[model samples]
Target: MRRSVISGLSAALVLTSAGVGGALLAPAASAAPASPALTTGVADGTYVSLKPTRMLDTRGSYLGRPLNAGEVYNLKVNGRGGVPSTGVSAVVLNMTVTAPTRAGNIVVYPKGSAVPNASSLNFVAKDTRANLVTVPVSSDGWVSIRNATGQTHVIADVQGYYVGSTTTKPAGAVDYFPDDPWRALDTRTAQDGPALAANDYLIQSVSYGANTANISALAVNVTAVNPQWTGFLNAWNGDENAIPNTSNLNFASRKTTSNMVIVPVTHGVGSDGTTPVLNFGIGNASPGTVDVIVDVVGVYATGDGLRFRSVGAPKRIVDTRTSLGATTLDAATTRTVTAPSTVTNSTTVALVTNATAVSPTAATYLTLWQTGVTRSAASNLNPAAGQTVANMAMVGLSDINQFDIYNNAGRTNVIVDVAGRMDLSPNLASGAAPSLSTRTAPKALGSRVATLR
Candidate 1:
């Protein structure tokens, strides 16, 4: 009856217990098999968008068995799905866990490396959850995933990858632009309509201001709230003919769940019917209706934007349990955590971090943003009482190199692990400003919609 998600690789990889909650498995006993030598240089830390593709689904033939406790699985990344076999430095994946037999944590690290004492996801028994992970790739084009407790099944869907930089920037590569995190859709609102009906699809326009032409993708967090039945949600580039067989977030009946989504963009007609706009589509695969909320944090575009720079591994920046940033964040309180000097050098403007709420005394959600701006109506992580949950966030950095985290409801400990940083592109055009546009309403896909049975 046990189930867990991980693929089979050579037995050379190893995983050992680190401790209790949030602690991940150890590194492999030896280095992973070496990859073919690359005559070109390393990655330049820019992104390349792709249509969503399913790379691993453990519930099916992939490994065909649940990943047991303390099991490490090396998944081949390069040359799989839409990713190139070489020249990849990192990848963006939406990771989901379902039917966990016991509560546990999931850690994702580059192949052959020691697992950092951090978790990419935390889930309880019989729960379904997903989180976005931007992981550095191993030299041999692979990454490892480990489960810390009872068996569970995992699913990984690739949305994009970062390429190596050479003397010349890779063609079609794009830079990142972090926004202040604004709400783009909420089906609960009257204007957007009621909760999404079962097996229906909705197309939502996301305004990129004047950056529409060059924008390749938008970084957004999508949440499903209080569904009438258990099921999942899928997002794509709004092309009616090419919906990927992937789910962005999963939820049980009456439960609220969220996941970060790097949705590719496509041009479409705006509300007025003639104005061109950028849009994406979300489809519900459940038997019941559910409310959907979307919040945009950033965008990917060519030229004059922030470039991504991945760290060797994710670094823990704040751990309230150890008083690293501060004591426990009390209910309705805000804490300003300064960025590490190493990641906040002159060129850096924002950080990509995994924010976790550890064993809160009561149900709560955490909101993160730059210190200078007002807190937007967006949350990065939402955890029930006594649950430890994590979600990836691209948080802007204020003038003083600081960002704020606000805890709602009861007191809880917070942990932030830095996966990468966004550096001001050296190619930024002189005097060009980067800003986010206002939120738009949702549009019914009508005859173009793909209904899931």
Candidate 2:
């Protein structure tokens, strides 16, 4: 069933660069009105990676039309694209919004729930943007997305899903280990050299030092800086023969964009026989060059690690515009943002949050990490002068359930939306919650542009 409201990686120690294109205009604010905090149960589950597949495209294959302003659309997520018909708790998707008529934000949540005061991504008029989203599914395996302004076409490619612990752990179930944010690649440096040329691919090894063993996949933030032409970037496990058809992020000429990517890794014994070496690839698909930055935030490994727990619909826990986390953050300053009183569970080791940078005074970036943890060189969101943008971030939390947001330059308001959290495996629960559908639609036939991996 489809309902309507309108709403809307990778590893490696190595990096590359690309060229610049056009400037992007700031989009309108997308946050819903503040509502009283609601109590939500934890959904513990293990991670499962699937062959990336295009699940929805509004242009032709799916809805066959653009979404209107303030509309909500619910798309079936489970029992398709390699996801199981039952037992799936959440899904990992790379969602793209293209040809928007006007600037607006995209909000996504579990089907049958009230719209939450948050956004999944923000975009300008006639812009093409993409962000990775991890969302919980309703009992019948569906999630709702809303487009906050103007008509836009949406595309989603499924990368993986989380299965509840109550169900038998499927083969290849991986546990997650949240690492301190670390910058593994920065192609801007002379050593890494020249921006990435169109159609060029770079392979780099990503390691977690002592924690490298048993690592199967990596959670990294991928940013395209000053892309010279309008194009997209593809990330994968470095399999030369099988490059995925999906794009990790889309960027315009000269505009900077970032997305969270969870990519499986190809492993090898390092030069030091005892250590493991994990590597992945990034390919540029544009007419010009662009710089690429990869930041490792977490790892997926077998054996012991943490499971994910859904927090129902995303919860707006921080709004800098209000007294929430102090007014707009100034350049080079950091502020502490605490979780809501409802998410005080000691089991919360990390959170899956959508962080937005609104109306930045200058082109700048924001980095998020736990309050007491040493700040990492990684950045979560990058917004051009006066541009409003959002990106998903998986951040660890301090002992007091607090985290910090640091602005790189100029003043900008920050908004944090909690989608889910990482918790101990023992806390993982089972069973599905009932949900009602809003709109019914025909099943998706196939993508207009077929790119299945």
Question: What are the TM-scores, per candidate, against the unseen true structure?
Answer: 0.86, 0.82
Per-candidate Cα lDDT values, in order, are: 0.75, 0.72
Kindly list the per-residue Cα lDDT of model 2 for residues 1-453, writing each as its tens digit: 000000111111111000111111223232222221222323347788876788878886566788778777788888888888888889998989999999998887788788788888889999999989989988988887788888999888889999864546776677776655556666786545456777777766655444455666888899999999999987887766777888889999999889999987786555456545676778888878889888777677664346788888888888888857556799999988877756447566678889999999999989988776568777899899998888999876666677889999999998888889876445222211111111111111111121223
Model 1 accuracy (lDDT, Cα): 0.75
Please provide, for model 1 over 277-338, each residue's C-alpha lDDT reduced to its tens digit, 9 standing for 90 to 100. Answer: 78788889998999999888777776445677877678888999998865689999999988
All-Cα superposition RMSD per candidate: 11.6, 12.8
Best by TM-score: 1
Segments in model 1 whose C-alpha atoms lie over 4 Å from true places:
1-43, 167-171, 271-273, 429-449
TM-score quality measure for candidate 2: 0.82
On the 0 to 100 scale, the lDDT of residue 112 in model 2 is: 76
Q: Name the 10 consecutive residues with the lowest summed lDDT in model 2.
A: 1-10
Lowest lDDT 10-residue stretch of candidate 1: 1-10
